[model samples]
Target: MAVSNVYYTNMRTTLQENLLQKLERLVRKAGMMDMDFENKFTAIKIHFGEPGNLAYLRPNYSKVLVDLIRSKGGRPFLTDCNTLYVGRRKNALDHLDAAYENGYNPFCTGCHMIIADGLKGTDEVLVPIDGEYVKEAKIGRALMDADIVISLTHFKGHESTGFGGALKNLGMGGGSRAGKMEMHNAGKPFVNQELCVGCGSCKKNCAHGAITIEDRKASIDVNKCVGCGRCIGACPVDAVDSMCDEANDILNKKIAEYTWAVLKDRPHFHVSLVVDVSPNCDCHSENDAAIVPNVGIFASFDPVALDMACVDAVNRQPVINGSYLAEQEHCHHDHFKDTHPDTNWETCIDHGVKLGLGNREYNLITI
Candidate 1:
């Protein structure tokens, strides 16, 4: 395979061009709407900000793409899967509520929110893949059911994957609870005994009765546990968390394979917003300081190239003061890698290239 092409546009604008208008122009230049969408069920996979998180892509940015797709005759629906760790977005109902609270209503973005997995996060389609870490990937039924898959992602730092971009958005975001469990660990959520009030919320929400509270604390029985991960979200004190057993490199490779499962055979395109360059996943209800100034949006037919371009763009800009870089020296390059020395973000991209998902080398075309 050859290097993929990634198109970009800086956040600069003339007096006549505002950000929204610039976005429309950029998408066109990036060929975002170049596909034939006539009557197709298009899934616009996006992360609606967790209610309190201020770093998610604004609905206005999405509207640009949504309008473009609509004009091309695609039936577009904004979607994401239920999360693995417990939170407001663990179940479809709660997920939808969080989306609405964050201003992702149809009136706002001109799209509907479909939790990819069913109401309980069980709806999925198993896709077999001969790979190092994953044998089969459990993808959200809604995403798989769509005729076209488009991802609109927020580029940011992640404790696990070094950073979150188009690949992370699809691979991790496309997973059902079980699939997410497969990607993360060996199917278990542990309770932080100190944070547990023994409120029984976990016990109440565990569909498989895997959680039992005793001595004013909660414990999960691995034997009875279905690894549904519902209890993680149910714990008010945030006591429950998914176990992280796989080494960072292995986890990154699994994420790449999962992304391949989601995008393979689908008419797919990607868009990543580099604004509000937060230093962690938007999965957190709150966002931290921007590590870099707001870069513009990027789009590509290749997710690996898109991620690489975003990383390159970030490195080009000087670090923001008082943001996580304070008192840090020799921040030479590869800031995300610097932040997470254990993780090799490139491993995922290299694996992705090997899987024919996309090429790592790319031509950075400015729009």
Candidate 2:
């Protein structure tokens, strides 16, 4: 296996170097300063936690990167695409509201926040990947328009795909609503008539004529539906949704493929903070107790190696007393697996290697 370099630093601070200053030194040593940011439109892809989830990374850390990028003459902005599910982040207006609620405003972060997919999450650019699962990825226009992409992720356990790391953030997070449906399902969508009020918004926006209205309800014609996910964005009532039926293994593979579409041939970098250690994704409306103590901050050019190193670090830590991981049976030896037995986080890592995203093996260089 090819070995990659993953730089790490423990969550220790002193009067001389606080965590923020420590982060700057770590990234600088990891070669973030080597990138040519001059005159580049840089998109810092980050998750603005769901309104009620307090486990997301604070906006303070982002300002450090923003200042560094601007110092190098790069025009940096914080960016994320709209969500597919019904939530505060399902559209640009509401998504911005959620971000603002989480303290991600320009004044706080020294940059602007952009909902990459525009008003309804329909604004997308189709990039051909021709991978095993996804032939073409529907990425947000703003992300595709950027000259450089930097993924700043919160490393934590995920209910569906094992763990949400750099690959999840760049691949799944970079996708437009249509692209998300492709990764989460069999590239098709269904309507819940109970929530549909026959507004005909879906039917009006669908270019393929895949949706119809009857009896004050809307139904989707799967045969005619192209699975563009425009209806999911069009539905005012949030009735349209993907089946979310894709097997976790395939879901992980598709995430790797989509990650390729976002980073291939682009100037890219990744950073992940193994703090909070939440047992579930930050997408949740409410955060449960953290599963483990904070490990540290990590940086790498190889995203796969970065994720691998993070999980290893987390597994090495003793589970917190009375935490979710502590309550589970420890037979698996892996903290993430013990917490969510059905999930195999390795699928994403091995598939990432297969797709040449990065090496799963690494030399962890502690800073």
Candidate 3:
């Protein structure tokens, strides 16, 4: 594997070219414009930032890409799959409302917004791939339907995967409800007996006869449970929950495989903004203070190299005083690891390399 080219530009901006202009210049210099996007349906995959999270990428940045793609005769739309967790983004209606509240309305992004997994988060296309962990990946239907995939990620620290970069955006973010269950857990969802109020919602919605209710408590039969994750979404009182017991390293590898499934046989591009540098993922409604100062924008054809560059850039920055990373023990040396001791981000990068997703060794071309 040769060194992939990862283009970068610092946060410095003159009066003439603002950050938006710099972003346009950066991606253009990185060769995104060279793709034959004419009349193609382009899916700009992004995290709209959990409702209260203020660290997400601004919709204005997306408008730059939207406008540029339109200039090339490409039809672009800002998109993200519904989250599996019980949150503002768990269903398409709630998810779109959250996106609109977070400033991702069509007027702001210069494009439409699509909840890739549809209303209930069950609309998906199963894609088979040969990998160590995942054999078949359930990807969001709208995401797979796009002619081109583009990950516009907020490069920030994540407690689960060490960091949420391109792989997290495309892999974990691309999965439908069931696909997320496969990545996050080894088995089906279990009912919290204490919280289960004899509600039959889970039982009624279960396509498989895996759920049983007795004595005002619901129980799940592992043998019959197919892990479709419908129960998790159907439980109105949030009594159902995924086991979520997958090891972080294995979770990273599965994420790599899912990303492969999304990008394989498609012309894909990546962009990561290392601005917030939060201690946890944006899935949290409340974002923590910045661990490190802001790095600039990164773009590449190689998602692996793009993540590598973003993490590398973050590692070089000095920690901010009073931030969560500053309070933690820094024996790990790497910023992400120091922030999240249990997580190993390298697993995703390595697995991506093994799956021929992209190269870890990158030439950082500063624009």
Candidate 4:
């Protein structure tokens, strides 16, 4: 593989050309318009910041891409699959409300917001990749149905993956509730008896008859439970939860395979904004101070190269004073490693390379 081209443009803007204009130029320079978008259904995958977390990419940024795609005759819609964790975005109705509350409605974005997975997070398409970890990946049906897939990622620190980039956004974010369970754990979900109110929500939602309520407590029969993660979402009290026991390296590898499943046989493009470099994922309700100063925006046809470039850019910046990274013992020279010692983000990139996703080597072309 050759060195992929990753286009970049700093946040600095003039009165005539603002940040949004710069983004348009960056993506165009990165060759986004090279694709044939006439009458195509384009899924612009993005994280609509988990309600209160202000670290997510603004709807203004997404509108830039949405408007551009529309100009090219593409029918664009902002999308993301429901999360495994209990939050505002765990189900479609709540997820749409969260998006709208965060100013991502069609009025603000010039496009509609669709929870890729259906109301219950079960509307998925089984794609068989036969990778080292995952065989058949369950991705949201709407995401897979798009004629073109574009990732508009908010690059930031993640506790599980070290950093959340294009692959993390597409791979993990594209997975249905069951698919997330497969990536996060090797075993079935267990009930937290203390949290269980015995509302029978889990038992009623279980299709396999693995859940039973006895003595005002719920228990899951592991032998019969298939780990679909429905009970986790169904529990009104959040009693049922994914074990999340997978090692970081294996989790990263599975994420790569899942990414492959999402982007396979599709015309895909990636754009990442390395701003408000938070210490944790946007899934958190609140965001801490940035670990580093705002870097810039990156776009590429190669998701691997795009992430590698953004990571490299972030590592070069000085750590922000009084931020989480500053307080941590900087044993590792890498900021992300110092911030999250146990996570190995390289596993995902290397796995992506092995799976013919894209080249790690990249040529950064400043716009």
> What RMSD does each model have against the real structure?
2.6, 1.0, 0.8, 0.8
- State the lDDT of candidate 2 residue by residue for 1-367, as single tens digits: 5688999998899989999998899899899989999999999999999999999999999998999999999999999999988888999999999999999999999999998989998899999989998999999999999999999999999998878999999999999998999999987999997888998999999999888888989998889988888898888888988999999999999999999999999998899999998999998998889898999999999999999999999988998998888888989889988888888989989988998999978999899
Per-residue lDDT tens digits for candidate 1, residues 142-193, read 9999999999999998888889999999998998887888788877878888
Candidate 4, run of 10 with poorest lDDT: 232-241
TM-score of 2: 0.98
lDDT per prediction? 0.86, 0.92, 0.94, 0.94
Candidate 1 TM-score versus the reference = 0.90
Evaluate residue 335 in candidate 1 and report its C-alpha lDDT on the 0 to 100 scale.
78
Lowest summed lDDT window (length 10), candidate 2: 186-195
* Model 4, residue pairs in steric clash: none
Determine the C-alpha RMSD for candidate 1 after optimal superposition of all C-alphas. Answer: 2.6
Q: After superposition, how far is residue 298 of candidate 1 from its true place, in Å?
A: 0.9
> By TM-score, how accurate is candidate 4?
0.99
Task: Candidate 1: give the clashing pairs.
Answer: 86-232, 86-233, 87-233
TM-scores of the candidates in the order shown: 0.90, 0.98, 0.99, 0.99
